[model samples]
Target: MSPQRFELLIGLYGDDRMAAILSEQELIASWLKVEAALATAQAEAGVIAADTAAVIAGAAVPATIEAGRLWRETRNVGYPILPLVRQLDEALPHEHRGRAHYGATTQDIMDTGLAVQFDAVGGRLTELTDAFGDAIAALATAHAHVVIAGRTHALQAVPTTFGAKMAGYLGELARDRARLVRAREEMTTVSLFGAGGTSAAYGEHAVKVRTRVAELLSLRASDIPWHVSRDRLAEFGAACALLAATCARFAREVVDLSRTEIAEVSEAAGHLRGASSTMPQKANPIESEAVIGMAVTAGALSSALYRIMEAGHERAAGEWQAEWQVLPQLAALAAGALGTARAVAEGLQVFPEAMRRNLGADSGLVMAEAYMIGLAPRLGRENAHDLVYAAARRCRATGESLQAVLSDMVPGEAAGAVAELRPEDYVGHPDVAIEAALARWRDRG
Candidate 1:
């Protein structure tokens, strides 16, 4: 019944749990929760009767509020809190009606509601990210010694294990997880400041009321009202963008390795899951494609959030309004990217023989670096590089193997060094790196 891609067709590019967290119904429920919490805080501070606070709390459930009327009034009033407060007050008994919203302002309810939603979203994202990292660690451990061609700038440069490549990604994911955890902790704070964030209306009891509200909502109380200081939200947005970019990096690797010419890896398929319309033999990297696409969208949305950080004065005219649209989209896109990445990691198909075939395709030219390093002690560094360069050109021109060319160009110790050099021999401690990455993931768990 939703109109957006993240809602209507969420299976393709969104997580249902994340979509629900950001849904309109949930937003309204969060606002009502904030109103109830504010009433409770005021009651604790002697600003309202305890019985009235309990009555307001009992009446603040979303089911008791009329959605259609609230929507209509929100449109007429240019904000939702006024209509929401009026509706909640009407739902209360005559004696307790006035205590519905207490001394809270529109932004107080709205901002605190956002914080509640953010706490839920952050927890879900953390769980998904941990699952994805575990999958990566498993893959790395399984392929710890499985050697493959290490590509640099679209060409094979040397040898590296698949585990090493996955380890690189795992390291980035760990850092991303840490950054997101910090940002979430910082941003999920209660926003209970009064109209102008000064709490002047509450006088001496403002801090106590704020603390009580935060405690009721299970959130952190801010030292000062952050009505215009949006860096916390911006930090969370930036972390999400970084996570999406990492997912895209992993997906891009899968896409390239699964290419027709490469065929070193692919996404698992069943029936006609990844089949093309015209080409019957096609089994596309659909999950990887989705991950990359969602990552790109998240990245763009994160940049928009950064721009919206400069809310004018104590409150914004347009910047704050823009956030209401951008934040949920960013969350949906990030959740989608993480889910797609998890699928990719769990169901990846690796072809060891195909990798070996591709690694051997260039007739041992990929080992040139190893050969040059071997010969450097004997021929001087510059001379050894020059010799290898000349031998590489000759091998390419004559369709001969680099080993054969090097055999003719160098003799004795230099030749022995070249003969000893092999693709697998040049992997350079990949297992050590992989173990280190897996250990980090384990520690995080």
Candidate 2:
């Protein structure tokens, strides 16, 4: 949140969703918009711009001379767009001062300005979400055939395809992608319900301007006032929250697999990977950690947005303006998170042998599920359950192999049960379920 970082996040929202919200060009554009709106409304009402709209539009250029001069004038308002308004006034000469921003509240121009900013920001979100989806799907495919120990409650449970685990993550991100789309669409609606959220000021022409602005920005315009209907904004923030949470979840998983105790997987080692200061043996997943940390800030940004949505009725300029900062920050955050996530996923080092070794480290004990299922048919459900359960209990007590205990279960002693069982027969449908999940993904497209 340093000043420079705060500013960079706004631009970098091109990569993630939370590091930034609005851009400088965005603020200027919105000012130019208020200028344009006034000019458009004036022309329709015979006030101005039947011919001067082009002049007004050209004045909005981010690199314009007037914009530079306005920058100098508004250096300290904490709201620079107002200086642009004065500068535009100077540019318009006299007969048009009345034509400028006529019959408009600051909210009128500011709201439309935000609508325009959100339009550009929303487009970037689509791109980032697409990248995240690609990363998850790619990870799922790459590891789909690699067997891994599926742990439950921090203990080994059964065998599973690494791809199956990744696919579960991918599924979560898929829902996230949909949530982002909905959030963007909801936030994309222009706030140009006109002055005071009513059409009284511009007479009959207010209707046309509202509709035209929505069309110009490729956004939907509501039939009624929503100056207080902030749910749409909350939707945008929530979408970012989901994306951040996804990143954190993915990062934590990477960290876990890279742990010394696990060592089943590691972040793809590269020349740029983190190095140790003392051990010289550590190649820490720093990028993964960074991604995890970013989630914290991104979540905060989403909360800021949620809080802003509780603004007083009609409009709240301060709260809305804060979004000018918050929204871009989140956008940049999600973008960067996705970028890092892609890098981490694509480079993951999976050890199938390690997975197999870990899968049954507890003295061939991970075969309990298969043993139960296999015995159910031979031992008449209840009897089979009691026998196997007792055997498993004895194995745990003595720290002996489950196979050793099963070997003593004799032919008639356990209702014709055999002791020559292998752990492979117990993994159930892990491979097939993984294959089917991937197949379903392919078909989903």
Candidate 3:
């Protein structure tokens, strides 16, 4: 495929770094690296002479192989490693040719090589996730006291700080980041079991060779072969899906808050940053929209991984091949989603005045619960709720503040108590919750 085919779309929906890591060249190079490591490990395990291992390793570089011929022969062979082995053998001295891919099967090299690729991709993703979290934490800290209307079922329900909203995003992302980190760690394990989930080909040196290869590759070594046990790969995809969903939640909120009627928050302004071609008076939440798109696509792609896990027996009939197509795309979509989320968050424009304005949009009915609680002590709880309910209806109908309506309906003592309740004062422990969230984010270091 032409590399530039998706260039335009990639800028909005794909991650360049992730794409590079999972590219064809990188995939071939990873396979070559695995061959080299296998030779080195075999030498250490006494399966091959050290000089022979060196000769194979020297010839294992991708430059020594013909990509066109390898791929053509792979088409006929139904696998690439045999063709790759043939190329490596041709590059080697006759004596060392036989030792090139000693004791390793096609799946062994492909799976282990994929693990190496995932290591790079996972590290990049973790960095992006952490950066996004940092931006959110900063927003949370900056807006800790900036109160906005808290909405439920699309209607104003109470008072809440924008910082607390940011903190909520931070909290979910922190947990998702942890899950991704763990899944990446688990997924990066070496796949050295020979054909049929057995190490019989390696004879006495199977465990040693696998261990040495894992050490050289900086991957985990497992005691059993996962030839058909694809849970690790499935888990990684699930984690990515979860992260995308969390980011989408935050993006959805940004889109809502940036609505023309709401106008409480906006994406940063720039020259045609979110420009409309025809309508010169429009600015959109472009990054957040892309984030949502990437998230939805990632979520859909990740679900396919579960089907891949249904592969039976010692090897998959065809399910294993699905991962090759699904994992990279899933990871790329997740990276795109997270990276764009960070961009939106870092450049987010928060308007405290707009937030304050929106808080009063419902004629101060949002503070009814606060007022009801304040009056509940003097009047009975049920009576206080009934009185506030009546006051809220009048406040909404007359376009007056809840305090004004309540004062007209209640006695002097109750009116005095209701007057003391403020929207800012009723944000409900956001300071404590935000601080705790900030502490958790810091500790993720």
Which candidate do you rate higher for TM-score, 1 or 3? Answer: 1
TM-score for each predicted model, relative to the true structure: 0.97, 0.86, 0.96
**Largest TM-score belongs to which candidate?**
1
In candidate 2, stretches whose alpha carbon ends up further than 4 angstroms from where it belongs are 1-21, 41-47, 65-81, 379-397, 409-424, 427-445
Q: What is the lDDT of residue 363 in candidate 2?
A: 69
List where candidate 3 sits over 4 angstroms from the true fold: 1-8, 411-413
**lDDT values for all models:** 0.86, 0.68, 0.88
Cα lDDT tens digits, model 1, 214-305, are 99999999868888889988988888888888999999999999999999999987899789999999898988999898888788878777
User: Which ten residues in a row are the worst by lDDT in model 2?
Assistant: 10-19
Residues 161-199, model 2: lDDT tens digits: 777788777767767777777777777666555556886
Between the candidate structures 1 and 2, which one is better when assessed by TM-score? 1
Better of 1 and 2 by lDDT: 1
lDDT score, candidate 3: 0.88
Highest lDDT: which candidate?
Answer: 3
Kindly report which residue pairs in candidate 1 clash with one another: none
Q: What's the distance in Å from true for residue 148, model 1?
A: 0.5
